[model samples]
Target: MGKFFYARVSSKDQNLARQIEAFKKMGAADEQIVCDKESGKNFNRENYKALKSALGLRAGDVLIVKELDRFGRNKQEILKELEYWKKREIRVMVIDIPTTMIDIPKGQEWIMEMINNILIEVLSSIAEQERDKIRQRQREGIDCMPVKNGKKVSTKTGRPVGRPEIKKPNNWSENYEKWVKGEITAKKAMENCKLKRSSFYKLVNEE
Candidate 1:
């Protein structure tokens, strides 16, 4: 039986040093540990998939993670993965969940299983809820951003925050005046301004 460790962080900018150190402290060799700097929302991470490959884990082998959420943040998906490991007889030991780290006597294994299930259920739910709260906060922050003309603007600089607004062509005023007097078609005005249909319409609608 082999022991394998997995570590994860939400983004490439985040550090995996702490989790790696924890694994090393537990006597896990570098080669036995795989780390992924990817979101915990899904199991589609590269290093994570490599760790779960057939050649990596096997029956009676142990898979260790620093925390339950390090395994994943989606509660249902996390539970599904745990069921997969259980069916394959691969032990998953989460360091933060102490009950998962204990070895149970053969006959009373159910007791440990029950306790571990309850703990995992609660922790995974919390993890997923935390992810949701983070996303909600991000949306709120974006929503609170000041809008300028027709775009979101930075409160500090009063400049657009997202895609830059398309500039009006130099001849826009002349052509727009002609179009307003019914002397030129809107399409003809757009052609004269050298702007695309959507760009011309967008500029026209902007105050």
Candidate 2:
């Protein structure tokens, strides 16, 4: 019964003017605009969490975001949220990607739905990469140019100062061969397996 606009910036120092203007152009009232100066890695953001927590988000409520990344970076998480919103009959519109807005052309709902899903998948992956960049800058606490191959180089020393790569744990071949082949990182594999540091290595050594 209501329209909601979500705008996010990774930090307070960033400007929200453009997003605010975009929301107004989309006919969102000033009060309907929800701003979050936080990461899009998850939904733990203050304003975003409050919006989700609020009651009465019934069917037909429209949630608008400036960009797909503004929604979140994780592909699985984004798709899951989209499915949940769809089931509740909520309309999710990503302004930059018109295909994402399914409220148009009821006659071509099927086609639009297909295109929308593809866009969601593609955009979410790109967003995740962008989120990594944001986290990189955040960890450094300053805006530094990222060098070749996603390495953060030192401004003064002119040398790579990236995170130290972890060696593949034992049983990485048996338990998570994907990590060994470099399809995924050891940390990611461990997270996917839900293994604690001790337990994961214990299994590794056991093998």
Estimate every model's Cα lDDT from 0 to 1.
0.90, 0.79
Residue pairs that clash (backbone atoms under 3 angstroms), model 1: none
Residue pairs in collision within model 2: none
Number of clashes found in candidate 2: 0
CA shift at 30, candidate 1, in angstroms?
A: 0.9
**Candidate 2, residue 122: lDDT:** 86
Q: Per-residue lDDT of 1-207 in model 2, one digit per residue for the tens?
A: 798899998788999999989999878898899999997777778887776675535688888999998888887889888898899898898999987664577688888888888888988999998878877876765345557567767777777775454455554565566766788876787887776676667666654
| Clash totals for all candidate models | 0, 0
Q: Cα deviation in Å at residue 126, candidate 2?
A: 0.6
Cα error, residue 134 of model 2, in Å, equals: 4.2
Candidate 1, 1-207: lDDT as tens digits:
899999999988999999999999999998999988888898988987876786679899999999998899999999999998899999999999988898888899999999999999999999999999999997897799987788888778888887666998888889888988999999999889888898888988983
lDDT of 1: 0.90
Highest TM-score among the candidates is held by which one?
1
